[model samples]
Target: MTLFVVSIILSAAMLHAVWNAIVKTAADRTTMLGLVALGHVIPGAAMVVLLPLPAPESMPYVLASTLIHFGYFYMLGRAYAHGDLSVVYPIARGIVPALVALWAMIFAGEVLPLQAWGGIALIALGIQLSSWQALRSGVESGVGRAALGYAVGTGFCISAYSLTDGLGVRLSGNTLSYWAWGAFLHLFVAGFIGLRKRNTLAALRPRTWIIGIGGGLVSMTAYGLVLYAKNFAPLGAVSALRETSVIFAALIGFVFLKEGNWIRRLGAAVLMAGGVALIGTSL
Candidate 1:
């Protein structure tokens, strides 16, 4: 990956972490998620009106991605319900790069070099390490096991959508158009959750509304950047780099939330940075 691509992905990773953190902390996760989806719809609707339609072939991928995101949101909410952000976030994101790489290899016929594979492995390891202690504790309990299951499910959803969007955006011929369409399709997600949570929506505090929608906008930008980067880099490389959101979340927790052991956070961050360096050099 070039410096430019790496920079874009890293920025996306940070923003990705931020939005996930917001969701993790929300009082009403489903309602908050619906608002986030609405956030995407607002901007997406405007852009769809202004931008040309994506290539006809790419519409199928866009539809497929939207369906996958429904599963992603559901699994994410379930995971957070069972485990702490430290535990849930790492496990959920840690598995994506390898899964995406495997899917890309099978479906897209994209085989990465050995060094790049090593980098992805290192990133996966570092992400898991970031939440090792919390994960271990969660595993020893029933709820933790439930969290583990849901988090793993979330990982699958993430990988599926990442590959879907990666291929979709590449074929779309216009990244912005593809992105806008994808965002606009999120209306389904918002509507589904909103209808289910209608009774609760009217009771939500103003703060919750603002934060949820704001996080949605941030999430949109983050994924938009990832889709843009996928156009230039291999899927596995981009996925691994993007999963650095785990590291960013850990750092955010340590610095701002005053959570976790410093030694562990620092160690995980170092490993992630080294992994990034390897991937950057491999290309």
Candidate 2:
């Protein structure tokens, strides 16, 4: 990957971490997530009006990606409800690069070099290190196995959509159009979640709307950058770099939410940064 592409992906990673932190600190995760979806819809709706449609070939991938994202959002909300940002975020984000690498190799025909694979492994290891305490003590600490299961499921959904969008954007012939349409699909996810929490909608405060919509916009921009990066880089390599957001999310949790063990988490973040640097060199 070029430095330009790597920088774009890293920026997206940071933004991704920020939005997740917003959701992590929210009082109502599901409702807040719905609002985030609204965030996506607002910009997406505007882009749809301004940009031309993606190729028909890309539509199937877009639909598939949207469906996978619904599952991702559902599992993410459930994971947060059952666990801390430090624990759930690491496991969910850590598992995706490997899965995406596998899928990219099989479907996208993108085979990475040994050094790149090593970098990816190191990144995943660093992510696990960030949550080592939580995983070791999760059961005794009452974090529960269910939360872990949900997080892993969320990871699967992430890999599914990452590959879907990676391919979809390449096929679309217009990165902006693909991203805009993908953002618009968030409306469906928000609508589905809103229907389930219909009673809460009337009671939501302005603060809630601001946080949720703002988070959605951040999340949309983050992933939009990733989609654009995929056009220039190998999917697996890009996915590995993007998972650095796990480290960012860890820091965000510690600083913003007052989560514990900052020293160790920061150390893990350093390790992840090193891993990203290795990947950059490999490229």
User: Which candidate leads in lDDT?
Assistant: 1
Candidate of highest TM-score: 1
How high is the lDDT of residue 128 in model 1?
85
Q: Which ten residues in a row have the lowest lDDT in candidate 2?
A: 251-260
Q: Tell me model 2's lDDT, rounded to 2 decimals.
A: 0.89
How many clashes in each candidate? 0, 0
In candidate 1, stretches whose alpha carbon ends up further than 4 angstroms from where it belongs are: none
- lDDT (10s digit) by residue, model 1, range 1-283: 7899999999999999899788767777778889989889999999999999999999999999999998898899888788866678788889999999999999999999999999899999999888888888777765546888999999999999999999999999999999999998889999999899998998888888889989999999999999999999999999999999988888887888887888987899888898899999998
Compared with the true structure, all predictions reach lDDT values of 0.90, 0.89
Please list all clashing residue pairs in model 1, or write none if there are none.
Answer: none
RMSD of each: 1.3, 1.6
What digit string (tens of lDDT, one per residue) describes model 2 on residues 1-283?
Answer: 7889989999999999899888877878788888989999999999999999999999999999999988898898889789876678778989999999999999989998888888899899989988788777776788888899999999999999999999999999999999999999888998998999999988989888888898998999999999999998889999999999878887777777676598888788777888788888887
- Assess candidate 1 and give its lDDT: 0.90
